[model samples]
Target: MNHLKIRSQFKYVQHKIEAIDKESFRYNYNVIEGDALMNTLEKISYETKFVAGSDGGSICKSSSKYHAIGDIEIKEEDIKVGKEKALGLFKAVEGYLLANPDAYN
Candidate 1:
């Protein structure tokens, strides 16, 4: 199944969005497309232009839409805690890699 990419960039974006008023949140997403099942990733050799189109942008949001994305719906406390866990994990992993450069191989 397709899962949202876990990256520090996404974490930063989440933190920034959280720091702002949550009530103001409307459009939220980074996924252009994803498969709901396994082995469904768009083939590496294929291109979206062949089927999708020139516009890589998402659909325009309606002002009436008030629903939030699933990832964003996590409890505020959990979001904060999750980021803290992520920060610690990142530091630990990177620190290990830096101390063992050959481990990258």
Candidate 2:
């Protein structure tokens, strides 16, 4: 994604995550708060993967699994989730960015 698009996407996820964080704090459940924080981290981690063009053929524009980050293996289930999340986030972000390219500064 482009710079401005990244900013907008960041805001979109950040807002939702902040809401969850607020609830966690209000409940005062240390365990729940930790879990929520980890969930938020997971979201951001997946978001990074989605943004870094690592979701497979679409983002990388190549089918060759030549390079890799680790000994990671891409299973069918993993592929399904990757595609879904990547495509979903892309549509959400790019759609908005297309309509309002200058949304972020």
Candidate 3:
């Protein structure tokens, strides 16, 4: 497994890569020190698999699970915001890959 740390003005995030291969990747992240800590967001786990598409491209299948601290329930709106941010990140990566065809090959 690989570990990464990201620091921003408002948050300190940690990422752990649990598994990776040609077809699948899995990881977990947590905001160790941030505004989210005050809100009880503990961690998030994600898994993504790539499969061959009918059109000779690769299709991505992904899932995310969120964890909350103790008995505090995560709000629906917060979950939606998280999902939207994840989608935006994915789209940005896709755009970069499309622009740089040889990247990560």
Candidate 4:
């Protein structure tokens, strides 16, 4: 994606992820608060396609990045959840980041 598009999508996902982090904080899930989670959320949001193609394949342009992330994979199932799906994907990425800190380091 272009810089503008990436920035816009980052903001969009960041807003949604902040809501999730707020709830996690309220519940004392302090582990959910960090830049790693935010980065993952931004990457997924910028890279994901909310819909699939007619052939049942991803329309997302960052297919290579998606493969690289591995555990943070966004499939058609997540897309089908509509608006709430971003949360699910964010949580998955958070978990992966938490478990694989060296991946980012």
Number of clashing residue pairs in every model? 0, 0, 0, 0
lDDT of 3 by residue, 22-66 (tens): 434433334344564456867677777777799998788878777
Q: What C-alpha lDDT, on a 0 to 100 scale, does residue 89 get in candidate 1?
A: 58
- By lDDT, the best candidate is 3
Query: Per-residue alpha-carbon lDDT of model 2 for 1-105, expressed as tens digits?
Result: 544333222222331222223332221111122222223232222212212344552242212121223554445675566456556766777678677767765
* Candidate 1 off by > 4 Å: 1-73
RMSD of 4: 17.0
What local distance difference test score does each model get?
0.35, 0.37, 0.66, 0.37
Q: State the TM-score for model 1.
A: 0.32
Ordered list by lDDT, greatest first: 3, 4, 2, 1
What's the CA error at residue 83 for candidate 3, in Å? 1.0
For model 4, the superposed segments whose C-alpha errors exceed 4 Å read: 1-81
Error of 1 at 53 (Å): 34
Q: Relative to the unseen true structure, what is the C-alpha lDDT of residue 59 in candidate 3, on a scale of 0 to 100?
A: 84
Worst 10 residues of 4 by lDDT: 1-10
Taking every candidate in turn, the Cα RMSD to the unseen true structure, in Å, is 17.3, 14.3, 5.4, 17.0
56-86, model 4: which lDDT tens digit per residue?
Answer: 8533322212222446656555445533444
User: Which of the two candidates, 1 or 3, achieves a greater lDDT against the reference?
Assistant: 3
Better of 2 and 4 by TM-score: 2
